[model samples]
Target: VRLRHALEVRSPTFDTQQFYDLAEKYGCAIVYAEDDEAPEWPKIDLETADFRYARLMSSKPDEPTGMTSAELDAIAKQTQAWAKRGDVFAYFIAGAKVRNPAAAQALIAKLA
Candidate 1:
């Protein structure tokens, strides 16, 4: 299961290391979420878990593929690295929902 805003809210007082340890103990992967509004959200590294989960929430309506080429390239690189470690699950969950499909296709091509 992925923790969204809850993680952000609790980060101030919560023991981050303990949280990660618990997740690892339970065979759960904390999500790495990217959002323009919540740029300060903690970025969990791929090495922290056996599997990876990422949410790409910065897709823009003005961009043809929901994201800029540079953004796609960066995501592709990160995903590739995560794939080397284990399974990777990424989703374009917010912003310009209509362009999510295009963003996904673009990312796939970059990964290819």
Candidate 2:
């Protein structure tokens, strides 16, 4: 089955190198770094999102799971902070929506 909760990284070019391996299994990817112009990501929106537990996709729990609650919270806070600081578009473009509608909307709201 095609998974909807996609993976997104904070610094696509920089952080991607660290998490791309972890993210490759997902349906999509996004990257928003500190200095990038527009974040690179495929098209996705709330209507297309579906949240799935990271453990379901993991063969090993010790490995990095992109959808962990902590990760989501951190990314949300960062996106929120960026938005409040007036870099809203940067946060949305940088964030990829693989399946988490709530988180995706949070990021998108910041963009708006």
**Which numbered prediction scores highest in lDDT against the true structure?**
1
- Determine which window of 10 residues in candidate 1 has minimal summed lDDT: 4-13
**Candidate 2: stretches off by over 4 Å:** 1-66, 90-112
RMSD of 2: 14.3
Alpha carbon lDDT of each predicted model: 0.76, 0.36
The per-candidate count of clashes, in order, stands at: 0, 6
Clashing pairs in 2: 4-98, 4-99, 5-98, 5-99, 6-98, 6-99
TM-score of each: 0.82, 0.28
Write the residue-wise lDDT of candidate 2 on 29-85 in tens digits.
433333122335222221112231111111122323324455556655655554443
Tens digits of per-residue lDDT for model 1 on 21-59?
A: 766666767778788867666666635567788888899
lDDT of 2: 0.36
- lDDT (0-100) at residue 95 of candidate 1? 64
